[model samples]
Target: MKITNETLATQLNHRSIRAFAKKPIAKEQLTAIYEAARHTSTSQFLQQFSILRITDEAKRKAISEIAKQDYVGGNGELLIFLADLNRNAKIRQHLGQDIARLQTADLFFQAVNDTVLAVQNALLAAESMGLGGVVLGSINNEPKKLVTVLELPQLTYPILGLQLGHPAQSPQLKPRLPLEFTVFDDKYPADFSLAEFKDYDKLVHQYYDLRDTDRRVDEFTTQIGSKKLAAHKSSRDEIMAAIQDQGLCLD
Candidate 1:
């Protein structure tokens, strides 16, 4: 038997909503969403994350261009979740404490975890209220440009972009790998086979994406083996430099 509730149902039925209605989210609802994000558990109670709600038209357009997604600037709310240690660093400095540890790889990952957790909480809150949205990792296509665009201070790095609003289109749910292939025993399984993914690949190839209804997307395994997964020369290649430029010493 399947054990579930309204929250589980909402999570299982999640679909990326690119198009949004012309209506605006109410102030109260937006506040509730923000509160949900703020209340998420952080690393050792150090809330090392900040949410930037982009309302400026020019900035939105610039972000859309950076993401290469038109819908990013079209409608709904754009919130950039940032792994932020700048505020905490300032606090430590004010108290006459050294902020050297704030730049370490450990602290950087902690902030990233805090930021990601907050994002899921905020998205669930919005979805519970009948809103839909998409997580935009494409925002990192030009990491340095994005840093410049947002004027991010030291000890802060962009983690993800979330666009939320009343959904205009209902896209079909994308398929996922079965639990047997993902969930393992206490120790890792000895080995796996490509044949295990055959059925899943067929299912994915059959599902039509709303982005391009004319033709079906590639199979999951095919996509995994494609150039899409290959490292290429792009602004994204300089992501480490960009993060270092922001004074985050990941080493």
Candidate 2:
């Protein structure tokens, strides 16, 4: 397929990195990545998001527990992005507005979405700069602890963590489902068959992910079908409570 320069290549080759070389990142690159994040668009200019760079060794070690992965503590840079609305709410409250009565799921979603976009922009920027990283949703496991640890104020919650470093291993590009399978016109359709993936699925199924490090991993279908996505109940409950505590009314 015809494509642009590094932009398309970097995005098309996106993959998670578990092993990072023990090298540290230079200050200029770090500054560039954060600058890229700053340019990302926000929701109605509210800018309801914040980023916390974790440079303290003890803190990194503590956060790695939430991820259950040691590489997070080892990566050159570990960052936590947060969805923040409390600051704005406090300002509105000072102006005689009821913060609690004015918040809803949609507002919470907006804050989360803005934070997420900034994270993606940072990821893309890092990739462009020849730095590797992985976004971790696993940190949701200890949202309250995270808030206390980072001393985050009200109306803000950790969205996720990022691990960045030089790549210690070269993993092959894993295949994806056909684009035609997901893209649609004006009206949404759900009755379409999964027929498009017959070949693509086999290609992906044959790929042996390298993270296992010693031998071949499971086939794509087997991995997806047998994966335990339900292993995260505490995270779900706590996140819901965090948002509620932030003055958002989900119900």
Candidate 3:
């Protein structure tokens, strides 16, 4: 028996929508989505997140280049979610209080959490309203470049980019690891084996990605083993330095 509600259905049917229709989202719907994001739970009642809506074609194109995703700058609403402690720092400066704590790694992590939660809330709200979107972690490929592109202030870092619009394609539902492999009891399993993923690997190999319909993507295990976990450093390697440059103390 499948027990589900509207929210559950929306979540279960989630697909990364890269291609979007030319139609613009209604102002009221956009407002509702923003409101939902604003109302997301914050750590210690400290809302450390900020959302930047990118409408300028030039900026969008620059961000797309940073992400290396053409669809990003094409058509849709582009929103960049940021982990921002600059606002709190300003508040403390105004009160003549110590602003050092705001720059700590602990506070930085809290702000990141706030930003990620807000993005989830915003995406779910949009999905509920019959919209489709994709989360662009790719923007972090060049953190410093992204900071320069957005003119991010001190004590703020870009967490993710969200592209929201009406979906133009219906892609196949991506498969996930079974509960036995993911969900565990109070304590984690004592041991696991790669052999356990054989069935899952087969299922994944059979799946076709909309991006490349000509051939099925590599199996889940192979993808992680070869590509995802491979240590080929790039601009992403400077992420920590970029964060520190933004005035966040990681040490």
Candidate 4:
């Protein structure tokens, strides 16, 4: 496809903005972003998601502390995206339908897919409007505490935290793996080479080094290996447990 449209250009140059200006986003822009998120396609027309706008300073700060990311709360606007099945549950209850049907892994994954798609659409909308934002996964550091802080009801779980605002800094766009490493044809390739990883790692290391000369940054392979080795210590390791407690029986 030719790079002819403004929308395509905006997406092509997408970058996360952590530092935000004090100025707030205009109401019209906020409305557009929400509309974009709401219009995202859902599985089987099940709109299994909700956007929780965090306006309270105390709550935002508390959330930031939990996430261990100060920029999350200090951003001009904060939104917690949730995979919500509570509304559907309520509807089923009203209609005398079996609530156990919502307890399947399929439905749970559908909610996750719905939430992610909606948030991606919202982020794209924000970028198209010249606004900047970042998706915060750090908020899941303490899922139980986050539930208490947000008071998320049953049949709902926090999926991601999104921060949006006027841009205060313009960081360089990080490198992405080549399409061959990710995108495939009709079927998966049986064998892959490490040549691409080596090339990408060098590029990434250069990017980080140039971006922040004060500190050393590990290469891509090292970073990935480190996380892989510490998989057990991941903050979201208890996700299934939390989901079960939230009444989403994914067994």
Per lDDT, the best of the predicted structures is 3
Clashes of 3: 0
Evaluate model 1: give its lDDT: 0.91
Worst 10 residues of 2 by lDDT: 227-236
Residue lDDT tens for model 4, 10-122: 88899989999999899999999999999999999989999999999999999999899879889589999999999999999999898786887789889999999999999
Pairs of colliding residues, candidate 1: none
Looking at candidate 1, the ten consecutive residues that score lowest on lDDT are 208-217
Pairs of colliding residues, candidate 2: none
lDDT of 2: 0.78
Clash count per candidate: 0, 0, 0, 0
Residue lDDT tens for model 2, 4-117: 787888898898777888898889988998898888898888888888999888888888887788787785899999888877888898998877633777777888888999
Worst 10 residues of 3 by lDDT: 208-217
| lDDT per residue as tens, model 1, 37-88 | 9999999999999999999899999999999999996789999999999999
Instruction: Determine the backbone clash count of candidate 2.
Output: 0
Clash pairs, model 3 backbone? none
lDDT of each residue in 1-251, candidate 3, tens digit only: 98999999999999889899999999999999999999999999899999999998899999999999899978889999999999989999999898888889999999999999999999999999989999999999999999999999999999999999999988778889999998988999999899999999888887754435547567888888786577787889999999999999656
The better-scoring model by lDDT among 3 and 4 is: 3
Q: Mark the regions of model 3 whose C-alpha exceeds 4 Å error after superposition.
A: 209-214
TM-scores, one per candidate? 0.96, 0.87, 0.96, 0.94
Q: Candidates' lDDT values, in order?
A: 0.91, 0.78, 0.91, 0.89
Evaluated at residue 46, the lDDT of candidate 2 is: 81
